[model samples]
Target: MDPTGNVGLLKCIYNIWKKPSKKAIIIYRWAKKMHDKNYKHIPIFLTNKLVVNYGSFISLNANIGRNLDFRHINGIVIGDGVTIANNVVIYQQVTLGGKNLGDFQKGNYPSIEDGVTIFAGAKIIGNITVGANSIVGANSVVINDVPANSVVAGIPAKVVKKLSY
Candidate 1:
């Protein structure tokens, strides 16, 4: 909470993200463990944290890379066998889980690549793959496979923007 405008806060945030502090990693692991215990509570606590602020009640088995940046920890559920790359930013109310939770199956999870940014209230299920540098908008429900450097939105997550970087 900075006294200045949003830009200053964003800049400060960027700086911290550029080089994640030891405290941040520690907190992230702590949050991960907390998430393991209670995915519901982790988001609320994570949102307040300067580091990783995420949500949901799930057993995330993703390969989360280093220097993660969780913007606004919301109602996110990361299931087992999922993978998250570096510099990935996940917003509130997102779900990353298996398609069939009741039917247990190995190696069936979502894979989120590097430099990805998932907006608030998005739901990603099944054995889908979110390409690198992709963006999933708020409240979008993703069930299909998203291309690299693309922006997906809407009820079923349609690609709206194609990132050229």
Candidate 2:
């Protein structure tokens, strides 16, 4: 049996069934697909259902890449127009949201690059870029751009370490 074939499919199904976060992610993916296919009403309904049932609010407009891994899903709010790259891991209570309320604009949300790990309770606000392969420490408030291959922590997060790879 090929691991990337039926076995992988089954494992993914099992994981989704066992985790609420994965279930929410799957639902969001489905909604996004439906939305892209011009099936508007159903996607809106599904998004509403997910927000009500899972405590996770993900904008259908957010562009997320492959292998989006969520450590926990509770209180995760991903705002509109946020772009997330591949292989990004996010923990609980994380907010990738706008800086100001009732002041909408294009490119107002954070752009998370590939291979980034955002720990629990991290709030990444406004139009900042979290560079590839970087780590956002838990409970950190990030208001500025983070360089690639670095670790950032503390309020108004600053680079604490630069990773080699």
Candidate 3:
């Protein structure tokens, strides 16, 4: 796998694993048993890297989408109760956490919509909403709601360009 282009295989597996029509949770529970071609380097600590409802996750409270593909998931930590929509792509070392500056209270976790691509080393914190079909570039830190079909890059990820639907 090139790890850069057309990672639809993972998306397909995730879709199957997230569906209610099939044994999605059961398959997700056995995901770690199946080797991830994208994540070749499995950490020693993770015995079975399945995608259960937090049983086999480092921070498994996060809800992964139906069509999700992740590359190099080392050191990646998503916040509790975060919602990831369908067809979302995430790169290595991404951190999707809630804002913390002492006693903090937010409504819900981050909601990343369908067809969104979050690049490597990006940190999206806070209870924000990332619109559909958006692309978050490498090393960006997004703390606010992002518009749909926008390409955001750089620190604090500004809208570089609006994608064409």
Scored by TM-score, the top model is 2
Q: Is candidate 2 or candidate 3 better by TM-score?
A: 2
Each model's lDDT comes to: 0.73, 0.92, 0.68
lDDT of 1 by residue, 19-85 (tens): 5333344555677776668777764475347323333343433457776665654455666678888
Model 2 lDDT per residue over 78-141, tens place: 9887899999999999999988874246568899999999999999999999999999999999
Ranked by lDDT, the better of candidates 1 and 3 is 1
Clashing pairs in model 1, backbone N/Cα/C closer than 3 A: 39-56, 43-54, 46-53, 53-73, 61-80, 62-82, 62-83, 63-83, 74-92, 75-93
Better by lDDT, candidate 3 or 2: 2
The order by descending TM-score is: 2, 1, 3
Q: Which candidate should be chosen as best, given lDDT against the real structure? A: 2
TM-score pick, better of 1 and 3: 1
* Colliding residue pairs in candidate 3: none
lDDT of 1 at 121: 84
lDDT of 3 by residue, 1-165 (tens): 657755787777777656532332344434434334334445322434333323323333456767576654455666665788898887767888777642124545678999999998898888888899999999999988899999998777789999997
TM-score of each: 0.67, 0.89, 0.64
Q: How close is each model in CA RMSD to the real structure?
A: 8.0, 2.7, 10.6
